[model samples]
Target: MSASAGVVVLGNTYDFFSRTRPRTVRRLAGRGQAKRARETAEKLLRDIIHAYDSVPSLTFRLLVVEDVATGGGGWTFTAENEYKVSCTLYAAAYYSTQVCVDDVLDQILNVGDRPGSLVPFNHTTTSLRGVVEAGQWVAAGQTLSWDTSQRGVEEPRPCIKRLSDPPIYRCVHEPEGVTVAAIRQETGTVLQITLNPLEYCRIGKGGAVFTK
Candidate 1:
């Protein structure tokens, strides 16, 4: 499927889950029981994923269900509960396929549900240069650049910012002086690197590093 079309499906999936979450939670909390809340949440998410997959044109897979805990809270809910859900969407490209729980939470209170309000996550394509020297190294200190002009393209640079966080860093087109973190030779001419928001640095040399 085309990337744009795939994104539309994803947004629709998120909206569907958001609108149904309240009902699912209520069913799980039948008679105000909290003891099985976590398990119930997990089952509900699995059921939702199955229901979504029945669309014939879409695929939904559960990745994780975490932080499912119950507690006493303010007026609205005497027994407050919190949980996080993560799922993977088989979209157009590998880079566009990862879906986190926060993406769904962002839509939880979206009253308008306007199409314009459903913004896809930020992503970019990156091009790396340099020769892989002895031992599959790309020469220490080599830099990489983000091709912001090619946003939404396949094989995008794996850079992401948390939706709720203050803008601490933003990837730019053609960022300069960005150092290499590490590199693994995927093929004779292609290389791959691991990216983790928490490990943006401290990863060693000859690797790709996304610049802010």
Candidate 2:
């Protein structure tokens, strides 16, 4: 990743719970339910932002926040060109009944740094940490190495690769996909799998159309 690499971040929240209750139960329900719910939602937003900052790949950018009020439902997240990822929190609480529940949905845009390259499916099982590094290829379905338990017991595991699903961003001229193919030794780079000439042309042109 380049030092100047950047990724967009977004966040939003909504609440649907009410505070009105029967006169007899008003004492139990009307005190702090809404306040708690809102606080929880806001805290979740902050946590999402902090998480984005923790990742080394992204230099955080705080774009403008746009909100809309819905009729009993939460708002939808709209992705703009600048927004590469979004985290939304939806909270509902019954103030009159002291019922509170909140859910968080994180939609990561641009997928990740090495989106087009194949990666080890079960990295936790790979024991060659720091030794193997990325961009090296073991035979398909072959055991690259073993992972050890806390007690230092080794368990064998195989190296696997897969094509990453595209994310909500402009598709650049990245390698088409990755496989269990050979990695270039001099550069420690994984070889991208071959594709149809037409598709290859598309990627090579950097999103431009080629004349017939």
Candidate 3:
């Protein structure tokens, strides 16, 4: 099948098995196995589309690699009879007029666009989480300065004293549904991230911080 903008394309299961599986296995499996696999893949795609629909800012398209010569990185089959579909999720933020400061700070700190003075030691200290938690902002070209005298460190440190620790958004597979597959926001990297929609009918949940 072909994919368009905001469209979900379900690949043919028989084609998938015929190309990927050994000739002996295909001969033994017959048409019934292929039909069952196709149904499972389609159901998984439907669940994925439903979950993503809740997030109005995000749009996605399934990547169906029909040709083995083209490569096969996005597809996955699990023992639990699940088909983990690989897809590209696009954000609407690119067309928005307003800037997302949180995203900007995330890029600066975690994505390698940090300032020269920003030390590599736990860059989370200079992250937006610290700024928002402390109800303060560091001005342009200036980093947070901390007194390390009592702590016995030689250099000045940036810290949010009262805040316990920063929360990390690690890429992990859920028991059932969608999860971030990878993030590629380094110095000159292009694609920001990839998401794998696991083959299960479950709704994805997440939280966002908003400011007026």
Candidate 4:
């Protein structure tokens, strides 16, 4: 049983319940509903403990927040080439949505800093904190991508693609006044989204990707 360095700085509804609810978890005594809250908090703590178990010793913080007053109407997402060689990708997209506190625990497993883009929330709190040994802390809402020069790549050439999907999903999306780029298909059964050098695509794969 190893110890967890991740600390839960704020428990959900702690301040709210403190002000509105008369009794604390310890004072709940035989109050059934309050007992349930205690159980839920314990479960959340366990989940948070596991989240920071492998985040490497770096300057990082997971700030969890949820409020009803404001949220993003839409979002922009991007990614870039992590390698040295320049490559041409066929397609790209940007998708994103608001982050919710109910899914914070699961975010580390799937979304991480991607969904941390929401604006400042007064009621929000830092639920977990850690220190990484090597890398600096990345800012919230910024995907890791490098700005690279496309000087060493082959010149853009005329290429064509033909699809043979008979009974399947078909889609086409492009905005007016914007020139469309290359169109490609997924590699085998695995989906392969390509990004150009110093480019990235941000998609809202946050809370929606988890089991509700």
Model 2 TM-score (2 dp):
0.21
- Total colliding residue pairs, candidate 1: 2
Q: Supply every candidate's count of residue pairs whose N, Cα or C atoms clash at under 3 angstroms.
A: 2, 0, 0, 15
Q: Against the unseen true structure, what C-alpha lDDT does each candidate score?
A: 0.25, 0.22, 0.26, 0.23
lDDT at 182 for candidate 3?
Answer: 20
Question: In candidate 2, which residue ranges exceed 4 Å CA deviation?
Answer: 1-32, 63-69, 72-212
Best by lDDT: 3
Model 3 — which ten-residue stretch has the worst lDDT? 88-97
lDDT of 1 by residue, 135-182 (tens): 121111221111122221124343343421111123321222221221
**How would the candidate models be sorted by lDDT, starting from the highest?**
3, 1, 4, 2
Clashing pairs in 3: none
The runs of at least 3 residues in candidate 1 whose Cα sits more than 4 Å from the true structure, single-residue gaps closed, are 1-33, 70-212
Tens-place lDDT per residue, model 3, 44-152, is 4344323322322323322221101111212334321222111111111011112243443343355233354322313555555544233223433222221122221
Worst 10 residues of 4 by lDDT: 184-193
Give the TM-score (vs. native) of candidate 3.
0.24
Q: Whole-model lDDT, candidate 1?
A: 0.25
Cα TM-score per model: 0.20, 0.21, 0.24, 0.18
lDDT of 4 by residue, 1-212 (tens): 22332222232233333231212211222234423433453344334323333323211211111101111111122121121111111222221112322232234333344354221111233232331111112233222211113211121222222331211111222232221121111111111112222211111213121010
Clash-forming residue pairs, model 2: none
lDDT preference between candidates 1 and 4, better one: 1
Better of 1 and 3 by TM-score: 3
Q: In model 4, where do residues sit more than 4 Å from their true spots?
A: 1-27, 56-111, 114-212
